[model samples]
Target: MKNILYTVLLVIGFSAAGTAQEINWVSLEEAVKLQKKNPKKIMMDVYTNWCGPCKMLDRNTFQNKDVAEYVNKHYYAVKFNAEGNEKINFNGREFANKGYNPANANRRNSVHDLAHYFSVRSYPTIVFLGDDSSLLAPVVGYQTPQQLELYLKLFKNNGHTVFKTQQDFQVYAEAFKPEFTN
Candidate 1:
């Protein structure tokens, strides 16, 4: 009976480990430094603490196994709080949320300079950047795993280069068949 219990516990542990989906998230500075060594596209999750859709995105989209695997393989993911008080230095410029009030934590605070630079007006914006730290595009709003797969493949495969016109992008979107389960 002791051996049976031990075996069951071991199986449970392994199952938990297997089910864990981890996205390889790094700081913007770390991503920039690492790009010098091995360049890859950057995917930034710009979210605010007070946003409900942002929380839903974290709980649903980012937690998806297929999304985690694809993002980890192709891009250096960065989670940036638009209302947080962290300073960021990118492209020889400094960025910070000057109006971040600790007294009003988790409420609608001031936006970060970086968020302004990216022209992020929404809470859950996914900013895509080139390997050289240039802005590719900004996808604003909460996206499901399957919904995000379109943009992921579009940028990853450099489809943006050819699909310059709105019509071209529309055609591509129409043809895209998402492979992600969730």
Candidate 2:
């Protein structure tokens, strides 16, 4: 019922039509491999299966047409399951969740070593990486399309590199003109 209503609203151009292409989410490893051929920043949606906000991020923010289009064009989107038992090869190192119990897959299993490497302790952290695959920063929690746009564009344009301090970032954020809708 909710999905149908959303589709209806989207078709009616609610927050700019919902008939947009979805983000081309690839695996982190695949993203790295693709980066070798085509240089682009990486936007990793590090989420856990049990997180409510993570699900909302997908349905409410990531589902937005503008977000999907912008991400697909300017970044290699990675939808990583933070607690899943997947082996990850990042920066010449292999990572895995040695403690992950398959039975607790949907109930918050052990954190993947890759999450630990990124210092992600939260459920839905948006980990940004440069074209060289270097960690830029992680924006924690759920963000609306407009809210996430700030970070998306900031990183996409290398705007995050100019901040000398947190206050500097606050000023830039305050002056940011968000172009993404819905």
Candidate 3:
């Protein structure tokens, strides 16, 4: 009887340990507010549900323990659905679903004005913003967990502003060491 009780307790403990709470995602407004307080940059994952690579990024890259820990530590991470219905206000402008197609099930709501404002041309685009919510350039295409780590560390350490070109970044990337740990 004692052995059975011990086994049950162990199972409960393991289950609790395995279930990690999802990352605490901040809304654009909340992020801006937090930026005023803490002065950290913003990392926005702009994704669409219909995009396979976006799903893969969420599953394989963002969900990785190292990636999550690094992002959570360095930046105010935000998951913004490029096709979602949430209203967003930025820089005295209101962005919403202005071009939604009701007939096409796969057609998502119109790209939010904020997405257009950032000039995002693809799904799963990762936009890194300055502490003042200014554009720091959007990185297109899918990135692996390690690849994203390089960018996170660079931007967090102010390397992006220091390097002038992709070649310069490559030089930095080659010698890059991640300052944040999992």
For each candidate in turn, the TM-score is 0.91, 0.89, 0.83
Cα misplacement distance, residue 89 of candidate 3 (Å): 0.6
Q: For candidate 3, list the clashing residue pairs, or say none.
A: none
lDDT of 1 by residue, 1-182 (tens): 99999999999999987896889899999999988999999999999888999999998999899999999999999999998899999999999988788976789888889999999999899999999999999999999999999999999998999976899999999999999986
Please give the lDDT score for candidate 2: 0.92
Off by over 4 Å in 1: 1-14
RMSD after Cα superposition, model 1: 2.6
The digit string of per-residue lDDT tens for model 3 on 66-103 reads 78777777789888888777789888888986775655
Best by lDDT: 1
Q: Rate the local accuracy (lDDT) of all candidates.
A: 0.93, 0.92, 0.82
Candidate 3 or 1, higher TM-score: 1
lDDT of 2 by residue, 20-76 (tens): 679999999999999999999999999999999999999999989899989999999
Q: Looking at model 3, which ten-residue stretch has the lowest summed lDDT? A: 100-109
- Clash totals in order: 0, 0, 0
